[model samples]
Target: MKFLLPIFAALLLSLTTVNARAAEHGTAEEAIALINKTAAYLIDEGPERTFFEVSNPRGRFTYRDLYVVIYDLQGRIMAHGMTPRLVGLNAMEYRDDDDKQFVREMIERAAKGQTGPVDYKWVHPQTQRLHAKSAYFRQVGLYVITAGIYK
Candidate 1:
């Protein structure tokens, strides 16, 4: 009976921690705000400094599960907050689980000077699982600034 009680306590603690982490995930509004903030930063600081800061995993551009990704007009990744390794790659042909060419779509939208949310499935950085995600983006000059929230 004593062992069962301790097990129950541990289970409760685990659930509590998981819930707390989930609560830390960013919201849709927050994602949009972050993208706007990144756009401003890019304008004020230019790509050199802006990309450096955004690529930093612990930088202000990354909060909770929301991170910034900067893509050039040509669909090349200029900076990435979550995965720095993808910074120099071209994700134009990248597709989600549903075979949606999300990166290409984002580029096309940005090229037309649009700002809004792009819905797609992506692997959550925290959960490492496929989850529905909506990324908010804005075109700043020749670059697209984006931030997303996992649903």
Candidate 2:
């Protein structure tokens, strides 16, 4: 019976470890997928009227209410759904010393026309949550759409 108890405890510990790993990886993976889907939409629709339908139902610049950012190859902010202060701003220079440096690096890579997944930790701008961000970049003309989430 003592051996059985030890065996059960070992099994429980292993399962907990495995589940924790899976949860961590799964959240980032899912956030990446969502970001990619939005990026694809930005590529197909472009910035001008892409949010027209959404804004009609919601209001002007409703997309800004969502956590999204679109930038040109020069790292200029093309469209952002989060911050009104970001519009027309040069994204390469926007910095928050308190946040992680991940987004800046991601923007630099995207400006060079690279498209892929970039993951990092940050203090979220909107939610104030400390989060892991998985951003996927998609190029459309001279612009790059980056969509991400806090996990």
Which residue runs of candidate 2 sit more than 4 Å off their true CA positions?
Answer: 1-46, 51-66, 95-104, 111-114
Model 1: how far residue 56 lies from native, Å: 0.3
User: Tens digit of lDDT per residue, candidate 2, span 1-151?
Assistant: 8879989999999999867644443343444454565556656776676433222423332332135566766677766655545667786645444444555677667767776567766566644766665666666666666666555
Measure candidate 1: CA RMSD: 1.1
Which lDDT tens digits does candidate 1 get at residues 115-137?
Answer: 76789999999889999998888
* Every model: Cα RMSD to truth: 1.1, 7.9
Q: Which structure among the candidates has the greatest TM-score?
A: 1
Worst lDDT 10-window in candidate 1:
109-118
* TM-scores for candidates 1 onward, in order: 0.95, 0.54
Question: Residue 49 of model 1: what lDDT?
Answer: 99
Off by over 4 Å in 1: none
